[model samples]
Target: MNSDRAAANDVDVDLGRLFGSLRRHWLGMLLFALISAALVFLLAAAATPKFRAETRVLIEQRETVFTRPQGEEAAVPAALDAEAIASQAEIMASAPILTKVARDFDLASLDEFDTSEPSFVEQFLTIIGMKADPIAVTPEEAVLASFREKLEIYRVENARVIVISFSSEDPRLAAAIPNAIADAYLENQRDARQQSNADATEWLEPEIADLRERVREVEERVARYRAESDLLIGQNNTVLATQQLSEISSELSRARAARAAAEADAQAARRALNGGGSLDTLPDVLESGLVERLRERQVDLQAQIADLSTTLLGNHPRIRALQSQLSDLDAQIGSEIRKIITGLETRAETARQREEDLTAEVNRLKAESARADEEQVELRALEREAAAQRELLESYLTRYREASARRDRDLLPVDARIFSRAIVPQEAYFPKVLPLTIAAFVAALLVGAIVLLLRELFSGRAMRPAYAHGETEAPSAASAKTGTAKPAAASPELPPAPRPLDMEPAAQVPTTPAGLTALDIEKAADRLVANGVTRALFISPEGDEAAAAAVLVAREIADTGLRVLLLDLTSTGAASRPMLETSSYAGITNILAAEAQFADIIHADLYSDCHVIPIGTADPARALSGIDRLPLIMNSLTTAYEIVLVECGVTDAAGIERLADDNTQIFVSLIDPEDEAIEETAEALKEEGFGSPVLVSPVGHEPETVPPGRTVA
Candidate 1:
């Protein structure tokens, strides 16, 4: 790719090839330039002009400004919780917060906003009957929301600043949109805080009610349980036990009196007459004795009755049988004296055992009663403490409720201030029209460059300037000889001018298919009736200017002393050296317009009686302007000279047609090896409306045989 580019640059300065190509395609470039420039100009004029405006909003580091004595002052936050406050600026751009700004400002309508050519909008408005053309082309609704959409905010890189920007057709509106959005953001923040407070209050109402219900339910259950279980002091069972025991003691005294009467007379005959009366007609239960014996007998009977259980109850058959036996025995004895003696034995032991057991049972009952009372008192105290705690909690909960209810109605955000102002910037804040246009144009140029380059490459054109010049020039070696005379040297000072023609006709020319020698040129001239060539244009293949001049000089000696025109038909004019003899001469380029006239421009040195037209030093513009008319211009010059010779130097095929008319014989010149390729160039000319070429000027080291087959007429 780089080599190809270098090759293209090489084509630029080669005057011959450049002129040729210019001569060929001059009309194309003109057409291209005119057509392109027109289309571009119209496209530019048809575009709508857009205007822009802007505003900047700096995100503050803190809500409150801080002052310091020396270093930079830090901003103080209104929030005691500084971290939450610091996050506000970042949150301003976050979706949750910015989304709120969008919603509050009602930004949904801007989705179809058109910022293209503004002229289209005027027609659209006129059709809708909304406005008097351009003056009133505004949306009927959702304007604020649309404006918020146009607004954009960004934190500046590595700076404590945020840039708020907006775009619109109207510059004032562009600025207004951002300011309105910033206000919306600030207002939204305040309302968001209030909303948060309302939500918290809403939740606490239900929680407070539930806590109260739970506390009341527990208190009610405690009260019901205590009342059902008889939770009072002296009315319980242990306290009533003593009165029942006293009633049982009165019944025992009555039983003792009955037994004493039965024992008064016993069976007195049965008694041994010493100590007591013995029962005779009525026997006593205590036969030998008194009341003590009668009571023991009655207790023995009671003890037997005690052994009888509930299966018999009081009316059991065995108990009744025993009762009958006891009655008969009482009858048979007919004395209470025996029963009283039996009662005496039982009375003392039973009373002592009953008293001991009653004492122990009373002591146990008193101890249990005391412990139970103590437990009840402690439980009551705990219950009271818990109730007091619950009451205190209820008081706090009530306070919380009041605070929430009041705060919900009147709450305000503590740190609400403008984090950034509604700034209207002096510079553009709207569509950014100029910068956008410039960017579009630059992008267009880059794309166009790529397109042009690819087009040139894909066309398969040769791109190398070196190829255009054929090859780099190496200084040619002079034809060396064995016995050649030392050529006449010019004097140190300038030599005297010769007559009109000073050529040696007798110089040996070589005639070979390879090229002409000096003697051969002389013979050729002799055949043409002594210097017979009239006006002639001599041409050669690429890189053959030196050989072309050698042939033209040979022609100058032939055919009536020809006058010559040797055109340096290259872009860079590299073939001028061979045309110079003693001092330099004026050239064909000098005859061009805005330069010297044709007669004055053509130089005639004293080299020969024959005159020569040297190749020109004209650039493309100068050459094409007047040299384009060169043939018509040259008609006047035929009167001054008899024969003409032109050194048609190495050149491209661009202007070959100029030398191809009936008045001119195009002599194709070549060197030995590359001369074979000259046929192809001839074919190209033929295709461009040129016929057969008069072959000449094939140079070699020495005179050689002219090959018949190789020579073409």
Candidate 2:
């Protein structure tokens, strides 16, 4: 077995072959690329270079404290969002603004903006009825159309800035147009604001006049209503009648309190007299100066009487005189106390009289206050109406004044301003000659290489036989039976095999001299199809060269219109390379390693209808970790395909057992029937209870060359 053959079979891309092909034609490819670049350079050089210039406008609240409306100066203006900026961009490109810019530049007279005649391509398309003819339009429309074509307006991403770009053959015009558009847009904004202000003032004029008249009328109505109802306002803004009633009620309360005091004093004096209590004990009597003096005299008289009685008998002159004086004093004091009692009664009567008068007056005032309250309700309603009118009139006046001031000063500001003006470009943005030429050259080279690859593929020189590496000459039937052979002379073509005398069917396996059955590629495929075998395992013990038998058998079965899949289980995809034309497909190993799925690994054979899974790029060691899944994967493949062919290269009976099932048919693929490995692998399969393995030979049926147009006999 040649290890190099495994490596050769495993390669997906032959870089050496690719480089060699390029090396053989590098001069021609380079020359073609250079010619393409030269053509692009010349075209770029001769082309009318158009210069592009852009003007940037910043959308923001441009109003300052002095210029802004009253009360707006302190407001934090919301920043323009992206949509607002985009709207501004649209406005900048509006027809009116563009028209102004065009007129300002007299763009209609400029040759750049003249589009009266159709282009050659357009005329050709129209003539062939591929495109409709353009409708007739005025020169202004034509010029506008041309102007619009060269204009590009967009808001800068994630920003509130708008960019206005224009292109022209004349760099100065290109620079001038965008600036003019920005200026026109600003002027338009100012004009719009001015118009709005003028409309506001015009509307407010009549409104203010009407409100003033209404305020005057309402005020007059309030005054008239107040006078008619006699609802005169007093101190503290209360109605006069209500105030008078309140004052009277307070005076009446005071009068009733004084009357009550007087009555109480008189009653207390009467009670003292009736109870025979001392007159001095009475508060009214004690408060009298006359009673106090009388009491003092009475006390002096009693002392005198007491002194006389101590010196003389009863009815003595001194005692008698003192007693008489004391009696006289008591009479006078009683008389005075009685007089005081009369005065208290008289005061009580006067107080009672006053209380009655106050109560009557209070009753009269209550009636007046109720009437006043009723009148005041209507009065208050009138005043409220007048007040509201006055307030509205004031607001209107203030707004009118502000609008007047603004109109006179022309203080309105546009929301957007030009932050950056367009400048005449030093270099043309179009016709970037050097870069375009280099790109053209690179593209041409790539295209040329692809064309060369296709040519090499169609000519069949890049393909080689799957078993070409380390191939040994197959021995004749007699030599194979004896297990000893000399190299046979090379023949132009393989001779036909002699038919068996019994004329055995193509589906029957022929018995070898050793009593072992062997089938050529076609006979093996026929036997599989006849038996309805869903799984066929090929053990390539003679190494990579013998694996060609598996590829040939799969192709033969596939040619019978059966859905066949060839699974390459070899260390290298020796068997898969001939069928798939590439070994770099993900397969059982990748599926086992969980690196790829069944869909990713399975690929259609390049030269036949058979599907194949290559040995894969995954590590074999990693794949073995999940080797237990091989039986499951085989079961899945068998369900999807009519026949599933597995090429197990140089694997033992234990390896075979892992992939084998009851329906599995084992074939020992052989390039040399006499090879010792074939016999050993067969014996091993038998020992493993896999039954006798059928020998499949590609000896006479192998293609001279593979992939492009090789076929089996």
Which is the leading candidate under lDDT? 2
Can you write out model 2's per-residue Cα lDDT over 1-713, one digit (the tens) per residue? 12322322331333465456788889989999999999999999999999999999988887777666666655535547777777878888899999888888898888767766789997898789886555556787778878998999998888888999999999999999999999999999899989999999999999999999999999999999989988889999998878888888888888888888989988999988999976687777879898899888888888777777888887887788888888888889899999999999999899889888878888987888899899888888999999999988888888888888989998887888888999999999999999999999999999888877665443322333243344333333332224442234443243432311111223333334275788788899999989978799899887887787788888778666566788988887787775543466677889999999876787756445567888888888999999888889988887766689999898998887877887889998766656677788788788878889998877666442222222211
TM-score of each: 0.32, 0.58
Mind giving the per-residue lDDT tens digits that candidate 1 earns over 206-271?
766876776676677556655544443344332233333344445445544444433332223234
Considering every candidate listed, which one attains the maximal TM-score? 2
lDDT of 1 at 616: 51
Cα shift from native, residue 72, model 1 (Å): 32
Give the Å shift of residue 525 in candidate 2: 39
* True lDDT of residue 164, candidate 1: 62
Regions more than 4 Å wrong, model 1 = 1-150, 156-163, 167-171, 222-409, 414-416, 429-713
